[model samples]
Target: MKKEKEIKPPIITDIQAIFDRARQAAIRSVDFERVMMYWQIGRRIIEEEQGGEQRAIYGERLIPYISEQLMPTLGSIFSTRNLIYIRQFYRTFPIANALRSQLSWTHYRSLSAISSIEKREFYLSETIKNNWTARQMERQINSHLFERLLSSTDKETLLSVARNEKQPADPKDIVKDPMILEFLGLKPESSYYEKDLETALITHLQEFMLELGNGYSFVARQKRIHLDGDDFFIDLVFYNRLLQCFVIVELKTHKLTHQDIGQLQMYVNYYDRIEKLPHEMPTVGILLCLEKNDTVVKFSLPENANIFASKYQLYLPTADQLQSELQKELSKQNVQ
Candidate 1:
C-alpha cells in the first residue's frame, strides 16, 4: 500500500481582523488626543484663572466667561457642564504620563461619576484588565460588583486582585455568592424547567459570560457522555482561561440537594480523568441553584474539593442591600 500524504489546512488571511485592528488603533489615538486636549484646556483655564496677575478680579464669573468664549469656537463639547467634567478630569488625573490610554473618554466619563477614589481605581484597573466597553463598565459599577466581591473576600485580597498584583487561586475568590441574571428575562416566580433556563442562557450567551466574570468562554451546552450504555449530559460547560480549568456548570431551577452535588462531582471527575489535558488543572464544578443550604454544602464536599455550590438570583439587588448582606455574611464567617 502507498503511504498517504498528510493533508494540511489552508491558510486564510483575516482581512477583517486587520481592518478591525487598524480601526481600533485609529479610535484609540483619537480618544487619547481628545482626552489630552480637555486636560490641557482645563489646565490653561485653571492656571489663567488663578495664576494670572488679576487673580481676584474674576473669581466667580471666570468659568461662565470661559464657557461663553470657548463654546462658539469649540462646539457643544465645551459647554459649562462638560467644562466641569474637564476640570474634574484634570483634577483626578494630574499627571499626563499616567493617563489610561486603553480606556475611552466614555469610560472615563462614567468612572468620573464615582466619588470614591479607591473604588474608581479598582474599576479603572478592572476595566483595563477585562477590556470592558463603556457600557459594560458602567453596568458593573452600577451592579456594585466591587462590593459583592469584597463581601466574599477580605479588603487586602480585593485590592491586590483589582490592582492586577495577584490572581485568584480558588473559584470562591472570584465567584459571586448569588449570580444575577436579570438579563435572561426570567422572573423569580416564573416556572421554568432546567432546559428552558439553559436555553435562555445560551440565547444570551454573551451576557451570561459577562455575568460569569473575566476570561470565561462557553464550551458546550448539554454535552453528552456515554459509558456502559449509559448516556449522561451536562447542562452547561465553560472554560475559564484565568483558572486554566474546565468549569462545569449544572443549573437547577429549584432548591439544591446533596444528590445534585454528587451528580456534579461525577461530571467533574469524568472531565479531570478523561477530558482535561495532562497540563491542565483539575475540573471545577459549579452547582448553580435557585436556593442552597449552607450546611448541606459544607457537609457534601470534601474540604479540598474544587466543587462549589452557589445560588442565582433573577434580579439585581440594590447596592445597600448587597453591602449589608455581605457584611453579615463576613461577620458570620469570622464567627465560625
Candidate 2:
C-alpha cells in the first residue's frame, strides 16, 4: 500500500518578520512626525498672530481664520477646536523630546486639560511608563488618584507607592469604601432582585471595575462551578494582574453575615487550589454588601485572611460623610 503524502507547513522566515516590524515602525514614525509638524505649525501660527508680542489682539482671532483656510486642505483634522488643541499641546509640551511617543494625540489632548504643570507631567510620565490606556488615564484623573495619594504620602513616597510591584500594603490602598453604582438606578432603599443587580452591574461594568481597584479585569459574571454533584455560582470573578490572583466578588443586597464570608472563602479556596498558577498569589475574596459588621469581620476571618468586606452605595456619598468617616478612622488609628 502506498503511504499517504505528508503536507508541509508554510515557512516563516526571520527576515520577513524583521521587515514587517520595520514597516510598522516606519509607519508609526511617519505618523508621529506629522503630528509634531502640525504642533509646530500651530505654535508658529500662534506666535505670528501675536506679532512677536504676547499681548497682540490677533491671538484671539487667528485660530479661526487659519482653521477656516486650512479645513478644506487639511480635511476634518484641522477643525478650529482641534487646531486650538494643537496650539495648547505645543504650549503644554514645549520640547518635542518631552512628548511621549507611546501616547496618541488624543492622550495629549486629555493631559492638556490638567492645569497644574507638575501634576500634568507626573500623570504623563506615569501613564506612559505604566502603559495606561486613554480610558484608564481618564479614570485615574476623575478619581483624583494623584491628590489622594499626595494627601497620604510625600511625593517620593507617593511615586514609590504608585509604582510598587506588590499588592497594596494597606486596606485603604486597595479598597474603595462605599463604591458608587449610580448606574444601577435603584435607590438604596428600593427592593431589587439579584438578576436586576447583576444586570445593572454588567451595564456599568467599566465603572465597577475601576472602583474595584487596579489590575482587575473581568473574568466572568455569575460564573457557575460544579463539584461533587453540587452547583455553585459566583457572582463575579476578576483576575488582578498586579496581585497575580483571582479576585472573587460576591454581591449581597443585605447585611453581611459569617455564612456569607464562609461561602466567599470557599470560593477563594477553590480558585486558589484549582485555577491559580503555581507562582500566583492566594485568591482574594471581597463581599460587596449593603452593610458589614466590622467587629464580626475582624473576628470571623484569620488575622491574615485575604478576604475583605466593603460596603457599596447607590449614589455618591455626601462629602461630609466621607470626611467624617475618614476622620474617625484616622483618630482610631492614631489612638492605636
| Candidate with maximal TM-score | 1
Model 1 Cα lDDT, one tens digit per residue, 1-336:
998987554433466667889999999999988988888987877787777676444576677777898799978887888888887777777788988889888887787777767678879998898788888788677556776565545666755554556887887666656787888898777789998899999998988887777678889999999978999999999998888999999999889999999999999999999999988878989998999998998899999888988898788766676667666766979999
Task: For each candidate in the order shown, give its overall lDDT on alpha carbons.
Answer: 0.82, 0.76
lDDT of 2 at 104: 69
Evaluate residue 65 in candidate 1 and report its C-alpha lDDT on the 0 to 100 scale.
74
Top-lDDT structure, candidate number: 1
Error of 1 at 264 (Å): 0.7
Candidate 2 residue-wise lDDT at 232: 99
- Candidate 1 Cα deviation (angstroms), residue 280: 1.3
Clashing pairs in 2: none
- Alpha-carbon runs more than 4 Å astray in model 1: 1-104, 112-144, 319-336
What shift in Å separates residue 111 of candidate 2 from its native position after superposition?
A: 3.0
